[model samples]
Target: MNVKPPSNAIPTTATAHAFEFSQVTSSAGEAWIDKNLGASQVATSSTDPASYGDLYQWDRPADEHQKRRTATITTLAVNTTPSHADFITATGPEGPYDWTIPNIGDVDDALHSAFFARTDGSGVCPTGFNVLTECN
Candidate 1:
């Protein structure tokens, strides 16, 4: 439970003033601070600050939702309505998908298929870390 920032991260003057890093170990672990990469719960209007970190729609990359990080929206649809039925006919191949449609059980529906995980390198985790998978 030693809390360390990612190696690629830089410490800014503001960050240095805001956070204190210590080598002293407690039962919980060593204390450190890092940039909030959308995983921090902060006070925002219309949301509960203490509840959870930012909530993301499925299949959307974490970059687009995080505050400190620049948003790179890769989804095909932005605000379009999704299909209630089995097939997602509107958004084409780019999707922030719901696993219910086109049949999650069907092997041909790659989006809903259990085998489908992002093959693309657009992962959400910090540098030097990987998104944990079922295999891990």
Candidate 2:
């Protein structure tokens, strides 16, 4: 699945670097996040970049959480039901925010396996890209 970009794809002033692409089946692609995303690894050691690009939680935006050294505020305990109070002081929007409850089949469950593309125009991703949804 390696693709060489067209000559025009590279900017005239920039040097093109060799990029590698690996072919993966649908099932293997679905399992990638659990096995590699957010997992601890030596960034400078002899390693493959495909094994580690970045890690992200379910529906949360790609913030500092991806970096191992970055500190994150844990608002709720795992598997606990979150209340309005839990998110009252959150920096973002108002209460009744979306969150996934652990182990229960309910709306806003972060663990719910589905495709969730952000449409709110929050700019969660680059201009031409959309957030990658969790694969069930």
Candidate 3:
């Protein structure tokens, strides 16, 4: 059947190197990835290296920025996709601490939400999978 993921998800082939995907189903009926964000294989335990996949910004696309050796930056992106793969670190105290922090006067919350919510909404998520978000 056509089970869609709940919310918050991972990308498919959008990462620096072609990422791999495996489908998994939850007890609650939500669909999901078989591995972690950067993992190529399923994890065997909590401390498995496969458990800790790539380390990119949580807000950006799977665009190579989260590579193990990726560069980190302080400058924010002005658009949906960033030109560089550097992980965008948080700026100063007046915190717009997410990579989705837009240029001043640009206030579209969907920037990050879209990517994290539905893969088709606006992100790199695979065909029928998404990361899970908390429900209130």
Over 11-86, each residue of candidate 3 has an lDDT whose tens digit, in order, gives: 3333323557556567965555666666767778878876677764545677778777788888767664788788
TM-scores for all predictions: 0.29, 0.32, 0.66
Q: After best superposition, candidate 3 residue 7: deviation in angstroms?
A: 12
**Highest TM-score model number:** 3
Candidate 1 local Cα displacement, residue 74, angstroms: 18
Taken over the whole model, the C-alpha lDDT of each candidate is 0.32, 0.32, 0.58
Clashes in model 3: which pairs? 7-131, 8-131, 9-131, 56-66
RMSD of 2: 11.2
Worst 10-residue lDDT window for candidate 1 reads 80-89
Cα displacement (Å) at residue 96, model 3: 7.4
Better of 1 and 2 by TM-score: 2
Q: What's the true lDDT of residue 22 in model 1?
A: 24
Clashes of 3: 4
